[model samples]
Target: MQELLEEALATLVPSDAEQAAVAALCDSLLARARKAAPDGVEPLLVGSVAKGTWLPGADIDLFLRFPEGADLKTEGLALARAVLPDGEELYAQHPYLRGSVEGYSIDAVPCFAISDPTQPASAVDRTVFHTSWVHDNLTDAQRNDVRLAKRFLAVAGAYGAAAAVGGFSGYLVEVLVHRAGDFPAFVEKVASWRPPVALGAVPGAPEAEITLPDPVDPGRNVAAGVMRDGLARAVLAARQFLAESTADAFVVGAAERKPLGCVTTVVLPHPGGVEETALPHIQRQGRKLVRALEPFGVLGSHCSLGNEGFIVLETAVVELPERQLHRGPAVWDAGAFEFLAAYPQAPLRDGRFWALKPPRHLDIASAVQALLPKARVVEGLADGAEPLPAA
Candidate 1:
């Protein structure tokens, strides 16, 4: 994994200046941790930092572990606040513990034991934190190798892409990390992961990639691709297939009633069907899907059929259907394309018929504005907006 990730992030290493800053930040945090828990406190770097795979705009992730007898909730909070006196304020809830210091968003998580310092965390008390006893019992070196593999996949952007396809969560990394003992074995497994056979967008085009094994009950070839193309493409294709195959995509966004500060949506034309019928079905299905998807965490969905019967998947904003025509799949000419393309909202890529993307940032108001140009500013809502879960 180290070999693979090093290759991908070859173009993504932090600059000397950035590295120095991180080092300084890590040192200060560690010093404070030690001071906070007079009796030894161990701090482990997790997320992109310890993984050695940070990209531009990455945040520093530090987990402070209080051996067996320390009080994590009380001590952790007081000490964190003391260090950052007047920095930007941040709130906290379950699983993740957050706060900001020196203007940088600082996420401090408490743990009982340090599994793979670089992998996503599992609360020690939960069996999920550790994995199959076999994988969990791997030697330190083997675990380090697994960390390397995760870094490699993450740097290659596979991890982020997978997260986007499915719901982005620490769990994906956890699953891969546990599979590390058999690095070669797991790679093979991931390579073989394929989407369901019935999920074809275009009748006979090509099967989409399902990079992870669980999604593909029977799986594909992990080491199938040589160098770069194989693994990356496979993972991306699989995600697209899964999005189409199951209602996972719709469900994820649907679970969130209101935009939870960040929103991402993907719209694509159905490859095989007619424009007239397909278009309306796509829009109606999309909206219905979003509402059905709410329990899974989606706020809403925006969908439209192109004049040519293409499926347009809109994310972030939830717009109602403007017209109810059933003409040959709403086929469009250059003029109609021009008008729709120029809609004040964010236009997807040029050649791509539809799009699947997240909000520019985790700012709900900004995301809403980007999605709905016609939406008027609602003052009281902005000031009284509820807090969202942490990243």
Candidate 2:
């Protein structure tokens, strides 16, 4: 196991040359930001790079800290824009600059230099404290453990905390590794976890399937974004790794698709918005379609957003029954009269009005088209469509 972990680390950890290049990029950005900023504004390095736990090709997170009274929405964004003139402004909690520089993705975020993490003026104010906490608490060895854990989760398709991914965040991985003392121990612990797992004594924390209160801010539930299925995937991956420790465990093999029945693919234009915001919207649309297609015996679905977005759905029945007995309100209810008025020849069965109506959509493709008028619905997957992940 130790040998396998070491091999994984060899591939996971950034090379010295790569680190040097990233450091140089960070230094240049810091200089540019400081030079462009007005008095009382401090430019600081944050995120994985500053904490020394960043993976190879990790996006650089550079925050410009403004004094408490400064307007983060306006002046903060202005500062970031000034620093990266070519960069595009994207909104999350607030607007920030995003661009690619020399093959590396860069984000110049503006935040308040708040004194208290617990009393953050904005959502991102606590991030600086999180960086500090990790630096103070985790040893060099444990940082590597965090890298291993992160890669493992990524391979298992359960690494990111994005609304689309609904999985663990990098900071959460650090905290979990810190608690377990190392990567192997963390895996062992996670393999035995049941749902509704709470790790800290945080008061008034919102209930979730997995609750890990943010150590930096007890009021926040760090694992609030983690979806149950994503957590289950991580747990199963951990169990498999424990049973047979091997380097192959760190690799993401092609997803084997064993669809139960008919497959329907919906292709649509990518919703233009910040990725964090757009992805959730796309997933919600996919889920809404899935629910609508329930009568067609929906088995599962996968939604992904890129240049163009796609939603792939599997169902036991491609075509629903032509005539459906539309149930109405009970005879004793006020709505029953309205139902009878609407369906003059409706029959009364089991004390409820029933109307035999032809289904609005007989097939899955037509159903998808009806739900998403602009979407291109295919009976099976589109040509060259990516396979759905393993169940």
Candidate 3:
């Protein structure tokens, strides 16, 4: 099952343009690093992208470990700007990693020293960043598991890989490791995942495609717009639930508190009940919000894209609902505004499904309410919305 799931998720790898951009960026960064440090060899690619387990629309991950005790900022930042050019516009500084270069954002992470290759990063964050092994080591299964784990999250809109890194979860890491069968089997133990509903797997008339009117790029079509909207609404619903539970306001609060920093969205699942008719609009707003939240923390989920729920990782589970609901990005229609307006706290179940546990912080109610308040409403099946009884 783990191997099967990994295979399915691997299908979502990035387009040729994205791959090229990343490769060019990496080569440039390496050039700059070698120039800056005469004694150093070139930097290496690490993380999901390096592992060849990255999902479609994932970021480029690179690792530059200067000889022990060397400062990475000088070499790393120089490489970053040289590749990206406009630091203010394209690059954004991250927590541990240097900064994300624009145009398929690339993460230039530094390598920390680790004594043992066997031990996990959880046990030794200060000594070594796990991404080192993610970039350097790992068997073929482990690499596949990384791709699978990322696709699961990317489709779920839990962690926008190119946008931020903090949203990455420990559970996801554990699940990937287990699935790879390198050590304990965590993914096999929690083997349920939601599959994404195919939106435009086939193309018809271009005029009919329901994508968002690209504000920045008018040439952009609408089927992708509809998909983005659906994903945005789904993500918003998850964020709202998290805010209610954690009391950690998203963009608004984060902006006021930390002007220089960005806001992070926790990945939680939503129950299916209401219609998701505003996927286009939701996607547009969601993308805009993502830009705003970039300085804080780019947050999202790892469930499949649409309806088939194989496994889900609900993070920040304190004070969470007992049961959680989930839906694919395609399941969200323009009609979601109707029920979501009436039932702020109710589950919107159409083609939607449920996860084994209630998502804690990824609730989209509050965010949706803020974004789509006119559509807010109290729902009927609000009391006990459990996962549809197992097949």
Please write out the lDDT profile of model 1 over residues 237-274, one tens digit for every residue.
34453344332211223223343423443333353443
TM-score of each: 0.40, 0.87, 0.37
Off by over 4 Å in 2: 254-260, 321-360, 382-387
lDDT of each: 0.42, 0.86, 0.39
Show model 1 residue runs off by greater than 4 Å. 1-8, 38-41, 67-73, 86-104, 112-192, 195-234, 237-391
Q: How big is the positional error of residue 54 in model 1, measured in Å on the Cα after superposition?
A: 3.3
The candidate that achieves the highest TM-score relative to the unseen native structure: 2
Per-residue CA lDDT of model 2 for 1-391, tens digit only, reads 8888898899989999999999999999999999999999999988999999999999999899998878888899889987778889888886799998889988999988898888855667778988999999999999999999998998888889987578898899999999999999999999998898878656787678788778888888888888987899889989998898878667767345577788888888889887787877778889899889988888888777777677888888888787988989999998888888889999888888889888888988888888889898877777644446674
lDDT of 3 by residue, 331-360 (tens): 366645554544445443466422244443
| Cα lDDT for residue 227, candidate 3 | 32
Per-prediction backbone clash count:
34, 0, 77
Model 3 misplacement above 4 A: 1-10, 14-25, 71-83, 88-102, 109-142, 154-188, 191-391
